[model samples]
Target chain A: MSEHTTLSDLEAAIDNTFATDAQQASVDVVEPGIVTAVETLSMQQALNRALAEVLEENPKALVLGEDVGLLGGVFRITDGLQKQFGEDRVFDTPLAESGILGMSVGLAMAGYHPIPEVQFDGFAYPAINQIVCQVGRMNYRSRGTMPMPITLRVPSFGGIRAPEHHGESLESLFAHVPGLKVVSPSSPNEAYHLLKHAATRPDPVIFMEPKSRYWQKGPVDTSADGYSPEGSRIVREGKHLTLVAWGAMVARCLQVAELAAEDGIDVEVLDLRWLKPIDAEGLAASVAKTRRAVVVHEAPLTSGLGAEVAALITERCFGTLRAPVERVTGFDVPYPSGDLEDEYVPNIDRILFGIQRVLENRRG
Target chain B: MAEISFPLPDLGEGLIEATVLEWLVAEGEQVERNHPLVEVETTKSAVELPSPQAGKVVKIYGGPGDTIKVGDPLIVFEVPDDTAGIVGTVPKEEAPRRRVRLTAALDDED
Candidate 1:
């Protein structure tokens, strides 16, 4: 900083930094294979443990959000963290998503890793300015000198019969932004590891926590390696068709896959965990094997993340695909409140019907 | 120059209150941080509570079997103005007896 500098010189330096970065390998993920000693944990407990570990493992990391400290979040995803990590490392913040995220940007620029929560998916709207203009752009905007090591948590998606704005899906919006890595973990196991992995990366990660799945219990292998930032995960193996999904929809797809099996229909379920950087290769591979695909998401169908996945599938698996990629998504309308949510969210029967559509539309 | 109050912190496992089992340090006795100040029995088990900072004990509230709430003042102390009985002390002409913000800064780990 003391050296004399010009705009051209800074641009040259920035170009050099990016060149090195492009050649640099992506984040190294430990492949903890066959972890057997796992504890049964709800998605909430797993997320809590992940944050606790982040604070404990990195002295530079902290957690901030509304009711995150004493109340432990509306979903209690951060329960007992304040006591375990102390108020300094884990504390509540004012009920302003923009302020919380703005503080995170400042803190990250100051060399602190901050995990700020938006409380609910809809709550992120107020913070869109900070998220898009600052958090996602700081690194590139600063010529790679000011990478934001932030994990912005958003308790997302539908199903617990909550009111409007409480059950919104914003994955499409987050993934569309440049420089933001969007990830949504569909289960307790994925939630535990993906969160830990997201917190460690030197970029901002939009961590979409499926709210309805928070209380569902599943085995979490702590010692297991976290999911790689590279691609989607194949949760079930089948040869007939692949059900591409993430978040709460993954569970619903799995159930539909089971039901599809009884009707002499074998299906594969692929959880597209990482929304941005869409894991095009993995999607192509899964669809290449199955030859048919149906994407399921909670967002509206018009320009939802499912459309992007469908396009990626078409681009890479066109010849191998026996049918065009189909999407079973929410209708193009505002996410309604409870009492109408059951019809709004894609259910098992709707997904099965979508699967049947793909099965019927044979591309000879 | 300052009277510092010590509230019973929530011990792990979500215990809200603890009954005084015994007093290990008498009033007016000087004790260092982490020194056993009193023994208390919770619903789970009996455990000794430690002095949070180095100070002269000015008063000890409650007797044996008396219950103390999680945030209730359990003891008070008298400490020098400069030597504030709390973490993250700053030099001030009139320093209030309060714990400073917890931080993870390299030299200021708390």
Candidate 2:
């Protein structure tokens, strides 16, 4: 039998044997229809609503992951989805990461949009082969004849003290890869809209969720057109230095900017929501105005996504820069134990240090 | 009533110690099966440990900022013999029921 046939048979056997009626009944069904009013929701809840909205509007979209069906995902982001959508659309799969990505590619090839959750940042390693080789290359390899619409959900970043492999800032790996679009949201409002955009886009998107900010709440305007993933947002505007960050670090940068303001230094904070197709122009513009720049992230310093942003700012705003771009990031080591994690991960002090370095280097 | 001690569980691989972040249930308070008893910050993540069975919070082992190792006593609960199977034995049906209720609550908010 063909490899696809074998996988299909295996999936069929697992579904037939394990997916019971009681499991379906056990999952609660949320009332249909999207919430239109402005409401405060945690990042997790906002992402959940975004997933539900996508599944509601697009019949071709389906969610599949381990514990996604009956358990509603480990983070409960997929809660109430299986019951509303049914087994075929929102079903659980065996604990095989490679199979998950491979099957998603096949599903996309068959004209279906599949949003598969990796469950955690570390678990994604097993499926890296499929993600980098197949999913990222399919559309270009097909000479534009094939369109792959797949959103891989990854819960990432530290600060929650999650054990090994659970808290990682691995977006840099995917961002370096050519065909995938990497997007991370720092707030609930951004999570809702960016998720909607990622789901609807006709390309593969690695949606990294900053797990530390999962419970961080903010107002989400459901009626507004969710911002496009093509550009960056100037969340806080200032004149002395540009603070560029995304995911969980955005909040940290804002806090750093607030602290800088008390010292009479106005810092402009830019959130690079889209990683792969980074907003080079917008970032350059921000740096040009501020004349100094600092990039912050929880990932390590060497070749981290922050390095790429720093390089881009250098390339675009070289003539206008008063100081070299500085990066604030985790050390170049494996994420340490919980006791040492606070020191390992970049905090407000480290970010402020970066800001201070750029300011000290500023041309008088 | 018999008092049972619940130890801090290993949240994930190689987690040695965790900080007691907050007490979800205070001492002398009644808690139902599966109700969250305490929130602890481990190396992996911040997790709320649920009460294993219906009981009264007889004593909490640590205060906020106290570091607790895996297998260290976390909470002490007093429970009647009939309801206490073990320190943390939650009813099988209660898990799904809680999920359903959470979904219902979110739906109401929507």
On residues A44-68, what C-alpha lDDT tens digit does candidate 2 reach at each position? 7899999988888788889999888
DockQ of each: 0.01, 0.03
Off by over 4 Å in 1: A1-36, A225-229, A362-364, B1-110
DockQ score of the complex predicted as candidate 1: 0.01
The CAPRI category of model 1 is incorrect
**lDDT of all predictions, in order shown?**
0.81, 0.80
Question: Which model scores highest in TM-score?
Answer: 2
Span of ten consecutive residues with least summed lDDT in model 2 chain A = A18-27
Candidate 2's TM-score reads 0.72
Model 1 has fnat of 0.00
Off by over 4 Å in 2: A1-35, A362-364, B1-110
